[model samples]
Target: MVGIIGYGVYIPRYRIKTVDIADVWGDDGEAVAQGLGVFEKSLPGPDEDVATISAEAARNAVKYAKIDPKEIGAVYIGSESHPYAVKPTGTIVAEAIGCSENMTCADFEFACKAGTAAVQTCMGLVTSKMVKYGLAIGADTAQGRPGDALEYSAAAGGAAYVIGEEDPVATIEATSSVTTDTPDFWRREGEDFPSHGARFTGEPAYFRHVEQGATNLFKKMGTSVDDYDYFVFHMPNGKFPVAMGKVLGVPKEKLEDSLVVRHIGNTYSGSSMVGLARVLDIAKPGSRIFMVSYGSGAGSDAFSIRVEDEIQSHRGEVPTVDDYIARKTYVSYSVYAKYRRTIKA
Candidate 1:
């Protein structure tokens, strides 16, 4: 019975309101905020690259897992934003988190779904006894081509999960996945941000993938969305997940507080896992949590998890979504452009 032994998350310290970006262009930020349900998005500093963000999340997860660094047998980093195109960010993260050299390490990419994809893969390694414990990290520093609508919500953040044998903190009961060759959003080589068909990204990319993944998981398990204590979805923006929930017959009441859209923006690869970490902060023993993640170029992964009695004891170590949101410092468009290195100094 392999499961999630511990979890952690990292959100950058800077924030930029949609209005701030809109204000500079004579556009109404209020309308954008209202439509997207996002007030601000996080921005990383020069020193905090994807590796650093992943390292922080791994540290927090290890702390809560109560496992020694040397005991970790594998590490998988999921990021489309690896700092170096040629080198592996997983090794750097393993070192930063103090994992042993005996561990297996690699990076995975599937857009935003890569994180949970790593989770599913790690579970396989543990269940098969190929390793004692494994770490899966989802981190991203998403770029939205300057002045694009994505620029207002595409953000940076990371989350890490430790997967191992049963008697664990959060156990995976079942899992399901769906994939299709859909180009709702994509970026070719040498592209900084992604390219999307705009309106198509919602129905074709996000909603379709998530709804199918969740429905298939629930139907096969013979359980409905109402049976779960909480639900989380990949939030590219606020509206997509909420809309998907409605179409899937998920109770509106169950989703209200769990949607992380307005507060954290769309964290690309880290979106759904980060939201799961938020729910873990308040989830009770015996609670069931359902999670679904979608990546553009389109794919979705869904999982069923049952919280253990130990969850309450470990929640204190991970920072809440609110904690991260409050510490953010604001930056103007000019400064944002400089930080992103989109402009020549």
Candidate 2:
């Protein structure tokens, strides 16, 4: 009975087309878009940050759970973009969400999979009776160096999950994680943007870690990809998930609805959590879900979720992920640059 009691996501309405970047750099827009399988990416408004996004998602999760916020005994936020170098984003989120003063809170950074790591921690706390209800958030204002390959895909957004035993929307069937010390991406102290290992970010990094996590989950739970109705992977871009799905024998249709990285880019820690929220929005009462998340440091977390009956009542109650997706307003590269603060006046 221990699982997600509620979930919510916050994605900015602003977007810049992938072709816009190629246009600026005199690269092939069509080829770039087709190659990455990402056409656009969400951009945070000047007022938005990891804290604001986390607060919105946490508030929505509380509302969806229909519980007193004071009952929240723990809050964990996963993100690399904590506003302060030393302050904890979890406490800010907890205070904004109205969680109790004596709450267990911390911020996590494991690259993109940080959000799922928070989820795993909350699950443990709630199931262990250490917390009545725990809040787990994955949010990021991810950035890419201008003209870099990641510029088109590194973007901003986040999602939150409330986990408990009371009236869950889904139940966790199984979970597994695999990690290695491989360095495919890094941003040094005081570095403005991250540097990647170029061709190394793919083969031995993202794909290898994600595939290993998925394969381990399959063997651990004795469940096949065919057992799930939908599948979601850490979408650094549209291409990676599809390519990994193929390697794992998952059909395109099963991965389609959750393949949102094509539209929103990578939200870093929020990447896969947002995808899971989208899947839950349309999942049937008995549908099964498969999710695997990858962080650039070379690690992946995989989980199996079975939709609960309570999901039917809440599916249309909140702002649908589709609504956010369709309500986008396009922005030019110059405006996008200004919004991201990458361009000095």
List the candidate 2 regions with Cα displacement exceeding 4 Å: none
Give the clash total for candidate 1: 0
Give the RMSD in angstroms, all C-alphas superposed, for model 2. Answer: 0.9
Q: Which ten residues in a row have the lowest lDDT in candidate 1?
A: 252-261
lDDT of each: 0.86, 0.90
- Model 1 C-alpha lDDT per residue in residues 75-100, reported as the tens digit of each score: 99888888998789999999998888
- lDDT (tens digit, per residue) of candidate 2 on 22-83: 99999999899999998999989989999999999888888888889899888889998889
| Whole-model alpha-carbon lDDT for candidate 2 | 0.90
- Each candidate's number of clashing pairs is 0, 0
* TM-score (C-alpha, index-matched) for candidate 1: 0.97
By how many angstroms RMSD does model 1 differ from the true structure?
1.2
